[model samples]
Target: MNLKVIAFDADDTLFINEPYFEEAEKKFCVLLEDYLSHQGLSRELFTTQVNNLPLYGYGIKGYILSMIEAAIKVSNGTISVDFIKKITEYGKDLIEKPIELIDGVEETLQALHGKYKLVVATKGDLKDQQRKLHKSGLGNYFHHIEVMDDKQEINYQKLVKRLDIQPSEFMMIGNSLKSDVLPVLEIGGYAIHIPFHTTWEHERIDHKVEHQNFSAVEKIIDVLKILQ
Candidate 1:
């Protein structure tokens, strides 16, 4: 494949992440249950989150803020301060949640670690991402860690340039086709998609990918066959 630097997305790719957010979201919906249906509340919360993206960027902290904002909106300013506090606590609990590595994650990394110049090219709050990586006990597998604020074509371009590798020499593995696969493929890099059970709405796309460099696998362990 002529790949030298291989990157992986952090959140759902390496370990469990979406379910934590989903669980927190359920609590948030219940907090506002008196105001709206759970589905409606979830929609409102997502709208608030998307609107606040530029101000807060992407992270659990911003998500907490979105929940609070949405709660206030849904409750028409009648939501109690105690409930707001609980919402904040939800974000905290998420941050403190244990690292649960995806099945076959360690085995996959163990096989590919030294063979490839591995990296974590992920998007999120740097501190939280760092904490998760530390907790995962998979730190030594990577040659470098890039906890970027976002992952897009330009961002991937800059990353490739910084690493001094040609676009074609880079490979990315992740669950999100929007953030991880398309962008890397846009820059002429190879990307392998390892789908997770839950995907955030913002990370979802409708079109099918038709790139020679793009591939999808059934699980993390399946990556071994393609890369080998």
Candidate 2:
């Protein structure tokens, strides 16, 4: 009952998204091979660069732009305009599709709606994330929704200050140990981590959790027992 706000992460935390990107990657690879054959760009090299794009951060625009630039580089500026257009269109399609909300998210949010202030703090492509939130229909449950550029220690502090809530009074619920749990705990906030069934390999990391304020769970519905 002491909780003032509960901030949730979108994407894997609330719904399924990784699969879409994986599917898009397949389409992108095909386009790359077709357009870069003359420059001797192997599929393996293209895959390496595409997979590494996450290093620049997650966003549809950034991902597409980087892929286009890479294609241009490998093709020695001989790549066709249509190839870029196809990849960009594919990226847009990835976002425009409906999202599959994780089981129990809707019910859990409804249970906590009036009891505690609700918010969504997610990181990724702005347009894709925003559209997902809108499509999820859980948008109305949250008082505020933040689409962050990066989930670093400073970002956590900024969110706490923006929401005008003390660390002890707010809780972050998410799936990623690195981005979701660590940064929040670093600032003295509480966090409940629910690991997603499947995660991108690049997002993988080991987290050392020694804080009494942080706990991990297997599912979102389980939080109701703690809060109630």
Candidate 3:
């Protein structure tokens, strides 16, 4: 492959992310357990979050609001102010969660840093993603960071144009097939999927992906085998 740019998805691709959100979600479920079953509460929270995506976009702040919205709906508007405060605290805790680098992330980045123009193409609140990259100590490896509002075919097209590279010369690496692989591949770019142990429910894809420019690997370090 004649790739000139290598882009990586930030969240679970570079470091630990989904598990922390899951943990916070469990707390949310418990806090509202009196009103509904854990499964029911999870369902409600998930629904609310998806509905709010267009309005609030994605991040801890939006999630915090979703939890509060879910809690109010479940409690029939009788939820106390203290519970709302606690829910807000959950989001703050998530924002401040320590950055845990994925195994072999640094090694993989080091191997390709100078060989190609590496950039971070991730979807989330710009500030949160920047903070995570800063905390991860992986900032210096990237030539640019694209904090997109969403990962879609058009988004990839825009990114390619901005980088001044042909679609065929760009490659994306990430944990989510829906956000990271499919969209990139759809735009005629190469993609490598390095699946994380846990994924967000919304990011899960029901169908297997098959593409000439796409490959799935067990770990981030394994990408070296293909790129080299």
Which 10-residue window of candidate 3 scores lowest in summed lDDT? 55-64
Candidate 1 lDDT, 1-228, residue by residue in tens: 899999999899999999999999999888788899999999999999999988888889889998999999998999898999999899999999999999999999999987989999987788999999999999999999998878889999999999999999999999999999998998899999999999999999999988899999999999999988
All-Cα superposition RMSD per candidate: 0.9, 3.7, 0.6
TM-score to native of every candidate shown: 0.98, 0.85, 0.99
| Most accurate candidate by TM-score | 3
TM-score of 3: 0.99
Pairs with steric clashes in candidate 1? none
lDDT of each: 0.93, 0.80, 0.95
Candidate 1 lDDT at 203 equals: 96
Pairs that collide, model 2 = none
Stretches of model 2 off by over 4 angstroms after superposition:
34-57
Q: Which lDDT tens digits does candidate 3 get at residues 1-228?
A: 899999999999999999999999999999999999999999999999999999988888889999999999999999999999999999999999999999999999999989999999998888999999999999999999999989999999999999999999999999999999998888899999999999889999999999999999999999999998
Order by lDDT, highest first: 3, 1, 2
Question: 156-214 in candidate 2: lDDT tens per residue?
Answer: 88998999988778899998888888888888888999988777665668756778888
